[model samples]
Target chain A: MLKINNLSATVDDGNKTILEALSLEVPAGEVHAIMGPNGAGKSTLSYVLTGRDGYDVTSGDVTLDGDDLLEMDPEERAAKGMFLSFQYPLEIPGVPTMTFLKTALNAQRRARGEEEMAAPEFLKKARALAKELKMKPEMLKRPLNVGFSGGEKKRMEIFQMMMLEPRFILMDETDSGLDVDALRIVADGVNKLRSPDRGMLIITHYQRLLDYIVPDRVHVLSGGKIAASGDADFAKKLEAEGYDAYAA
Target chain B: MTHMPLKLENLPTRRDEAWKWTDVRGRVSETSAGLSVAGLPKFTLPDGITVSEVETDDLDTDSAMAKLARNFGGKVWAVSVPEGFSSDTPLIIEGLNRGHIRIRIDIAKGASLSVIEHHAGDAGGFVNVDMTVTLKAEAKFDRTIVHNDPADCVRIATAHITAWNDAAVTQHALSFGGALSRIETRLAGMGKHIEATLNGAYLLDDKRHCDMTSYIDLAVPDCTIRQAVKGVVTDKSRGVFQGKFHVRRPAQHTDAEMRHDALMLSDTSEIRSKPELEIYADDVACAHGNTIGQLDESALFYMRQRGIPLAEARALLTEAFVADVFDDLDDEDLRESLLGKIREWLKEG
Candidate 1:
């Protein structure tokens, strides 16, 4: 469902190249994990895919469901079923969490020529999801991610992902700031949303997250390219050792 | 000795330190005809309130614009609230559409009142208003000014407020600019343990201009003062904010803070802000903050990435930035009305 061919990118016209001729594909009904160390361009790959600024693609072709994703703006890509769970979720002051969710949902629906959800229906679904995610309902009333704990923010991300219900999901360093318990809860939420028609890319440096939501395929990213590909066991072996050999 | 009809020479110029940024003298033509004596404003009073004309000759003031208002305006319209009078409904003051006008409002001891001054005075004419409000001991006064004028008019409205011991004073003003418009407020804390809050917001579009200037004095001990003003300037519009908090030596427990924040949306749009705190009391806590810049790009990108269009995202962020000033307003309906006006302003162009 998601394909990348010969992706070569730079840091916005800079001399340094962050992504080499890297190529990877995740088919429908599967979850893939990209494991890399610091400076391995793990986050850069997610940002480039989601059409964030400050990154220039020198030569690459990315397609989602056979549609050219690179040509679309960030919002357009979002409306086309692309979702990025940011490594560090921003604190958008004055925008209530529930209101933001409703807006995002409606905007995507509007873009896709679907009817907007009514307030009562949206509230009912949101309240149920908040309970299942173990998030306090009151947190939804506060400004989006403002004054929320690290665990709460990660949970909120999962909450948003569930609300938007995108076809392609990019989980960028989702476990960076989460504790063990929060990691379990977040992983459980992701596991419940897994389906045969959706594709998931989990980007992380450690194998701890894979223990909860195991990936179908694991790729070792080194020097901005896929150095190795193996089954989910690869993640356990790399965790025992380290990225030292891959860093070379 | 001053003449009957005030000439344009009586207006303050850019050379004057107070009107440096807002130059009425330069904007008004020198060869234009002088201003004549004008009548009082139309008032929609609540129960137990009446208006009477008092001679303006008894009023003496330093402000050049106020002096012009007193001299050209024939009399001061007076409105008094009886002792211990508290009302759930606000007293509405309207029809401040033209000419020079002066008003004096007195709140008796232990009384509470709310005043809504609606200014839609955007005719091709010039308007000058001088208003004074005095609060007796332990009185509570809430004043809200909603002003919107188009690009063809010039307006200057100034208010002088005095609060006695243990009195509570709250003022909130929202303005959409005229050709050249200014809402100036000067508040004095006259007794012990008084609390005062002065907050305002302005949204200027096109070639409209609006200036919100306030001076607060904490003259007595144990008085607390808070002031915050937020503004947004779009297209070729200009928004100005000047706020100062003065704490005297005798006001030992004085706690005052002033904040002025503005957002410039277009390349040609302009925003000028000055927030000052002058404290002579060694034991007092006084602070001031001022910022003039565009909206946060990171925040904008975040919102857009969530599927909101760029323009909608910008409007939402701008609304939130300007909506913070009215968070403490006691009247929920009035607060929502102000926010609705802000949203309407954002939706236009």
Candidate 2:
């Protein structure tokens, strides 16, 4: 449902390119993985896709379900069912997670001319989802992501994604800071949410996460573009041999 | 030294030096009582505080100041702890005023109390209040000042605090309304082992203006003062903050710190801040900082990426920014009321 055609982008105007002629496609009902080394423009891809201000799209078109994504602001993208799980989730002090999540969910709903859900209904749904993710109810009582450990922060990201239930989500290095247990739990959360009508582009540096949530397709991103495409076996080989094979 | 025959010609309230930026003397001349305040809300507090003031519009300024300046002609309406009476319920006091309000509150010695003062008005008048707090030997006190009035009202408040030997005091001031508003906290540390924690937050919108000025004097040895002030400015609103920390030569072991941060929501919004530290003591720990900027774009992006709209994200960040001032409040009910006002202000901001 998401398509990137020869997308070349830079962090700023006339700056060094972060992504050069990078192109990828994730059809509906598919899960794609982009594995790359550090400074390999993995996060840049996420920023460019989400239309963050610093990322300048040099030459390319990003379309979501055949609709131009570049013309939309960050909030517009969110309204159109777009989500990005950041590598480092911001710690918003004094903003209770419950209040923040409801505001977000309702904003998305309001943009689509839907009625806002009552607090009781929201609490019911949120409490159930939080339980399934093994997140303590008290965690949601605190400020958004403040004082949460690296693992807890990643889990909260998944929790937020679950609450949004978006059509497409770009998870950028969500597994980097997570420990083994956290990775397993996070992988399970992602797997549980996978559906044929939804799409996700999982970006990471390692293939260990693949063992838990196997991808339908693997794209090796090197030199700012997808150099090779294959099945999950490609991920296994890349894990074994590293990016030297793709770099050459 | 002040009289209030509040004239409608003073619409913008910009007639005095302190009211230059926040002129409410001309634009408007009346206050609208919110639904909540009109009910004459009374807080449930401890320490047997019976403070009930009926607001009356007295057109004559000089006569009103002379009569109400000493607290409505009573026995100097003071709060005492019987030298050792300490109930942790937190002393709560409410004052009702319509036109010009003048009141003075004094806290007794060797006592500990948390007091919350709230001002709600709808008229284009003025409120001049003076609060003097004295901390006896080894005494302690904590105070919170909550201000929420419309753009047509004016509140010029002064607080004078003196901490005796081994005394500790903390003051938190939160302002969200007023046309030409200025709250000054002047503290004198005359006692050794004295400490003061001062924090303030203000939000200005429309053509609104708010000023917060503080002066803490370390007149004795081994005294410490800590201050932090934050503000959010929007519309064509303007705000000013001036903070000064002074340490005398005899205050050798003095420790003081002051920091101010401001957030401008609109391009035309204005923020002015000045921080000064004067220390003649040989050994003292003093630091001060001032920062002014717009909201964080990265944080906004991060919030929006998770399905939060821009406005919602901005409100969340603004709440977080100002909530820091209310951290030291020991009373729960008063804290919640102030926090609720903060939420409403951000939504309207």
Candidate 3:
């Protein structure tokens, strides 16, 4: 379970406050979707939760399983079962995808006081997962996200999320660049990871993505605050009518 | 053999444009005051290769260092590869505590040879090495030079190579800088249709200094050349790369590219590069690029976000930055060994 109480954050070293005393909570065994228009601080919320630099949290408390998440480093937050699917995945040249994945998995395990996975076991798991995701084996050998298509990049991000199996997942605008087929495949990957012990907060601008994953609750974010909360029908109504009335 | 006193004043100084970033004169004066010759280390040649000790009288007198190496009273060890002979085994020549050495390698027509020269010594002293490599028509030669000397020692080496018609020559050099280490290479392409590649890299930390200066001449028609040099400097270390390519008027269809990239891990670290092209030919493809920068911050953040610690992320990026230069080596074990050395060096910082 993840809880954010009165979470307010700023950009440019607190010059601009993007999130104004925003509060939200997604309990375990639930999927929450935050539907907001452009500049509604959806991405900022994800970054602040993940402890990325350049985002100053003005005042807020973010706890995961009753543990304060704000006091940890980015990697520490990651090891504590937090995963963020970036809106724009980074291209890390010279590091093969397989190597990066293995390192991430092992590093997280090590941080959690678990034994490192052997090479053969890691390879087998990676190969099987990659094949299921329709990714070529050679793609795993290339540099991470370098020269990959937009669809391929999104698929790779989901592949990593599936492999790491974090306790709390933040899908930041995961539906922005994906086509219908890619959206379906990515949604399927996310759907398969759904469980009673894991919580997911999906952020998107449109309601089309909700049809695939079918969130349990939908929160409309406007003016850096949750303006409304409703069930799955709220997403369809907002998509059909738009967020103009909800704008501040 | 008589021991000649080195004239420090005659050495190249920083006032010279070519040696501006490298204070060879000052370093030599400070370290070569009480330098003495140690016992020459013996060399064992691989099978099918012949070795002979020759006189150093025929060496070129282009610079003070070359002249010093020629007149230093050290016997020139020459290795010859007969015509049409090819072998995968590499001949290794090591300079362990040897004061001065002159090496000459001659490959006859259509022969192939590979050589690895390692310069290392634990005792604090001066090392001078001069080598001449001649490749006859249709010959192929590959050479790898590794310089890992003592922290207190000063090493100066020069290699002059000549490639005849249709000959292919490749040279790779890696230097973990010492108090002052310099490797200078001069390559000349004679006759037509020759291919040559000059690759070098340096990893330096602390107050160490390493300079790689090269001059390649494309004299005949249809010769191709490539030069890629990379460096990683941390702490207060300094690295320098000066490369020049000259395409003569007769070399009509020449193609050459030179690139030098460096990563400065610390603010105090320094990397200076100068890539020059002199073209007299109307039809040639010549390009040069140089960049000196720190690691990509976003890339670092991305790696860290994936759970890799800061130090590990930095080491990974640094290794990736210098990995391409070693990708051309044919020996997998040697390549991995060199990469492992690089990784170890990165961890030390």
Largest DockQ belongs to which candidate?
3
Q: What C-alpha lDDT values do all the predictions have?
A: 0.88, 0.77, 0.86
Q: lDDT, candidate 1, residue A84?
A: 91
Q: Model 3, range B224-313, lDDT digits (tens) per residue?
A: 898899999999999999999999899999999999999999999988888899999999999999999999887777777788888989
> Chain B TM-score of all predictions, in order?
0.96, 0.81, 0.95
Model 3 residue B336 lDDT score? 89
Q: Considering DockQ, where higher is better, how would the candidates rank from best to worst?
A: 3, 1, 2
Worst 10 residues of 3 chain A by lDDT: A169-178
Best first by TM-score, ranked: 3, 1, 2
The worst-scoring run of ten residues by lDDT in candidate 2 chain A lies at A239-248
lDDT of 3: 0.86
Per-residue lDDT of candidate 1, residues B195-302 (tens digit): 988999999988888999998887799998888899999899998888888888898988888888899999999988778888888998888888888988877777
Listed in order, each prediction's TM-score against the native is 0.96, 0.78, 0.97
lDDT by residue for model 3 (A1-248), tens: 79999989999978998998888999998999999999999888988998888999889899999999999988898999999998899999899998998988899999999999999998998888888888899999999999998888889999999888999889988887889988998999999999999999999998999999999999989999899999999999999989998896
lDDT of 1 at A130: 95
All candidates: interface RMSD = 0.9, 1.4, 0.9
Off by over 4 Å in 3: B30-41, B96-98
